[model samples]
Target: MRKTAPKKRRWSSGGLAAKQFSAKMANNEKCETKPEQSEKNEVLEELNSQKRKFDKIAEKLQSIEETVSKIAKLNDDEEKSMMKFKEQIESLEKSNLLNDRSNEKLVTRKSFVVKYVFENLEKYKFDISKEEEHFSMNWHMEMQKNNGYLGIYLFAEPIPPFNDDWSIEAKLEFKMIGKNNSSVIKTGEGIFEGLDGNGFDDFLKWEEMREDYLIDNKLTVEVNVEILKRTGFGKNNIREFDESQKEVSDVILVVQDTKFYVQKMYLALQSSYFKALFFGKFNESEKSEIELKDIEADDFQNFLELIHGESSVDDDTVTGILNLADMYDSPTAIRRCEEFLLKKSKKSTVQKLQLALRCNLEHLKNKCLSKITTISDIKSIMAANLPEMDLSTSQALLQKSLGFWDE
Candidate 1:
């Protein structure tokens, strides 16, 4: 009875309460762990999103860098292409200039012909002796083109007897007559003295004469005879003095604040520039004094001295004198200056070469070139004072250098 009673009461209150408490504690622990896991998952998702955004930005930056690199390469290519095009254009222009120069040289090798004749043999004859004791004759001269040569032939009638000890002298003048007698194209004087009874005959190459001297295929010839007179102390003999006084200077040349008393005739005879300024149709012909600008007084004085044949040339003054001679168109002074420069060219090679190029002195230029023996000498000359040279002179020097290399 006692054992049965204990089993029936096996479910006590205290044991039941403990079992409920344990179950409740297990449920609360599960709820707390669920919230913590949810929160951790949300944080992981946010981190993944940020990583994707960073990857996308990196990809865009790489694309932009590639585009910039390609653009820079294209710009470089364009610059190279433009440089090549410009070089090609310069080459084409140089080729065109060479072609033009070649065309000009072909046109300068042309020739022309001219001729003339004279008549009336007796109209130009004169007696050589007062008593007419010496033999004399009348002659006619003719000028004509024969086989591309100018032929000057003299014709005479009743040929004079030839004498071994005596010779008949005749003076002949040839003139190129212009249209309407405007001006004499040119005049040539010749003297003929020989014992040969046959008249004198002369020939000249047509190409050798000046082109301006030939006028409308015609020329004129005049003949005169030299008279012989006895020379002794006699009543008929008289002493004569020149009695020709120099005319007063009519023009004054003021150069660099210095005044120069210049004769119009003297200047006109020495320089065509002065002749035109003083005697031509210009207004300066009426002026008594001309003020020259940009001319040095000392240089002008040296020029005057050269013209008057009262000075000697030196290295220091030769270049200045040559420049003045060229400016004034004084051929005599030019010739004199060129002669002096040519003699000094051996010692002053570079100086004379530069001067020759500046003054257009062909013979002096040739002499200067002859003095240079090697390419080193040429290079030295070109390097020295190159900036002081003019454009034409520089071009001439380049051409000369090229010629030397070609040789």
Candidate 2:
């Protein structure tokens, strides 16, 4: 059963007021005033009833306002939740794309190998390998012999221009070779960023390795690192150059053992190098495969994609693509790179000037040199790693510096 509030006695006050009024009239002998007093009491009771109704209406208005405010707050919370969900989805997509697969469009699958040689294993306490340059970064190894266990550590000595907030994922294989053609191989993977490194302290038992794997008091271990991913140095590839489109591809150009499959006439029309090799008297014209030397496969891929009307050049890859484009005499590729550098690139003025001078990009060269109005600007451009600037460019900068001092 439902329970409700007790009822209020509203009629007692009006009855008491009427009795008091009648007593005052009887004592004053004003029987004729009784009618007027009754009318006045009626009006007072009506006003009290109207006041109660007003109080009830005010309470309802307050409740309605509270309800509206709560609804508005709920709407805001739902919008915030939706925005957070969208951000999480985007972040997950980026992680999924880069985690498992190494992108071919912006890569060199094979990094260099360095061998660490140990001699007289029982005599030396600790040894290290000479640092070698791979992927434009230094790498070496450190070995420690402790308590009948050998600790092996491979490190990527982070170098300049990549020292800040940079990271690389590499698949590593370390092999310990024996004199009798037997080997103990250890394979691992690591992500090198900042001060964090990876290694195995108890890599092998020293006694057994020295007894079985020693070669006349010497041991040779090979370390191979293949970089799978890199970040914070601008390695994004906007276009794909996969050769799986085999039905349209005619030949594969191999660079440093990396293959790029493409059509002959498409490249031949864009570059004289391909034209002469594919259609001219060269032996490569008749062959289905060719080798390009002293070039990065990633750069070549971006260069080919750019010539085919793909936007693939950026600050990190513009230099390499220009190097190949200038070598192969691809006019369209050169123009596109020059245009990007002049208008869109965020490279420093000094760096852009050097690239302009080296590639003989006349339009870019003039624009960069013209931007150099002060002596300090000229000094900065000169101090950078600049190739031999042509005579005309040198004269222009010299004249600009002298003119600035005079002004």
- The runs of at least 3 residues in candidate 1 whose Cα sits more than 4 Å from the true structure, single-residue gaps closed, are 1-247, 344-347, 385-407
Best by lDDT: 2
The TM-score, computed over Cα atoms with residue i paired to residue i, of candidate 2 is: 0.45
List TM-score per model, in order. 0.36, 0.45
Which RMSD values do the candidates have, in order? 54.1, 41.6
**lDDT by candidate, in order shown:** 0.46, 0.63
Candidate 2 lDDT, tens digit per residue, 104-132?
Answer: 12222445466766774556656667675
What is the per-residue lDDT of model 1 for residues 356-395, given as tens digits with 9 covering 90 to 100?
Answer: 7656788987777677665556555643433234444444
How much lDDT does candidate 1 score? 0.46
What clash pairs does model 1 have? none
TM-score between candidate 1 and the true structure? 0.36
Cα lDDT for residue 73, candidate 1: 71
